[model samples]
Target: MAAPSAARSLLLCVMVTAFLHHLQLQIPPVATAAAASPNKTDGRDDGRGKTFSLTLYQHETINKTAYMVVDGVTGAGVSQTTTPFGTIYVFRDDLTVSADRASRVAGVAEGSSITTSLDGLQSLSLAKITLHGHRGHRGSVSVLGGTYNTKPSDYPVVGGTGDFAYALGYVRSSPLDLRGRTVTYKMELHLYWPPYAHYAPVPHKPV
Candidate 1:
């Protein structure tokens, strides 16, 4: 009886070992750390962030897109080329794909500039650039900063809405044409969105 009991216990131990081995074989292997992480090289969720650039042409003309509704202490009117200190100029400029005014209209830049310098060479500008026509580009970016009349100026991108949500960057505005009653600017936007901000890459036209 003792020998039979010993043989039964040995058989049970062998069965348990075989069952564990079979279970181990049936289970799948654990994934490696590199394989489990999201791919970062393709400008996606790699924890770095995404960047985009755009070049737009802004056209402003007196009595059309630009207006001086408020007169300064010096009594400068809309017809004047220069504004005096305390003058408020409002504009709803046309943004085009190219420098030509007849080119495809991409959007609108609506904002106001208050003359801050006595010589009217500088002003505080605030604008909301609302984009349109282009697919995958559906939003507005807010720009605000000081602008110099004679030289290129950069304004900070303070906020955004719609597809440009959580946008951050700066706009480098260079005067393309500042003749007669019309003024044109080449607006180069260097934009960025954080990793947490959802965004899709939009096809951009050549600058």
Candidate 2:
């Protein structure tokens, strides 16, 4: 008996996504200022301010020239490998975020993500995201990290640069389209930033 095409496709997607997740975990995490101090961002589960959501529509293109193919996780390749680190995949994205569906693009996100295979199904991933807004006065923010198994389905927002300095939170993404080589992702972000620059301290309410 043979499996259905849709089911097979979905299964393959899941397997590939899982493999990519595993690949992401292998990348060494860069130590951020926020990460260095455990006391500051104490609770990874707890963050400040209201939970704001951003609808991020992402488009990626994969090819061999985007990234230098390395021999292993840490090796810096002198020459390009035929495959995307043996997977024939490397993509750069100029994603846009919106407040509404098909509305004017609010912000521009620029970054590149790579997928590498260790051996067989074993794989790795590396992604870097930087965000900038046109209408806002506040500075931009960036998210840098590796993902594994795609489980937890969410990764920390880590820290940011500019007016949004010291920002920390988490992000989760869902696939909107899977067109074999190309994929579209709808990413939802939950960010925690420092309190208002000039705001009154809250007096405790009568209990």
Candidate 3:
């Protein structure tokens, strides 16, 4: 009788322990992460109408004369290709486009298109950009033709492929230095792209 009584008491204690454990599991003591975090939203648009700035360094090669029509005066298909080394900035973020001499052509300009399309325009260009690692359209940058040197040029950012699919904006190019046959230019590109705005191909338009 004594042994049975002891056994029953032990069983009661065990059952009580299990009941307490079950109660603790039903009401966990941990606080939710969301509730503990500060209440603040990310301060950026959802990629629509977003603007970016690129500070590009262009080295007009010694071969620019080869594409010159009248030795840098004017001619059809007179285009110059420059290799660039610089940084692209988005607010405070920065990325390097300069690379292991892969010899990326920063941009191309044709004097003939400028001369024929726009009347009597001196110091102009039919600017088409192509940068390595640039979000250009289908492996090419849609043409951006305009007078990009009128007291510091502001050329349109027509259309692009890759990340710049329906890209729109302008590029302001200012001369940084002139070295004999190699000129250096600093181009500030202000870019904007919108959703569903890309893929809408347009006819050739002069700006």
Candidate whose lDDT is highest: 1
Tell me the tens digit of each residue's lDDT in model 3 across 105-137. 544432233233222323335445555444442
As a whole number from 0 to 100, the lDDT of residue 148 in candidate 1 is: 81
lDDT score for residue 14 of model 3? 100
User: Which ranges in model 3 have alpha carbons more than 4 Å from their true place?
Assistant: 1-49, 62-66, 70-121, 134-140, 143-145, 148-150, 195-207
Worst 10 residues of 3 by lDDT: 84-93
TM-score of each: 0.69, 0.46, 0.45
Sort the predicted structures by TM-score, highest score first. 1, 2, 3
- The model with the greatest TM-score is 1
Error of 1 at 124 (Å): 0.4
- lDDT of candidate 3 vs native? 0.44
RMSD of every candidate to native, in Å, equals 8.3, 28.5, 13.8
Q: Quantify all predictions' global Cα lDDT against the true fold.
A: 0.76, 0.46, 0.44
Write model 2 residue lDDT over 1-207, tens digit each, in one string: 355988999999999999999999997776443244333322233333322335566654344214434333432332222222333334555555642335454444454434444322223443445455433423545565433222224555656666445666656655565444444566666555554211222222212
| Candidate 2 vs 3: which has more lDDT | 2
* Candidate order by decreasing lDDT: 1, 2, 3
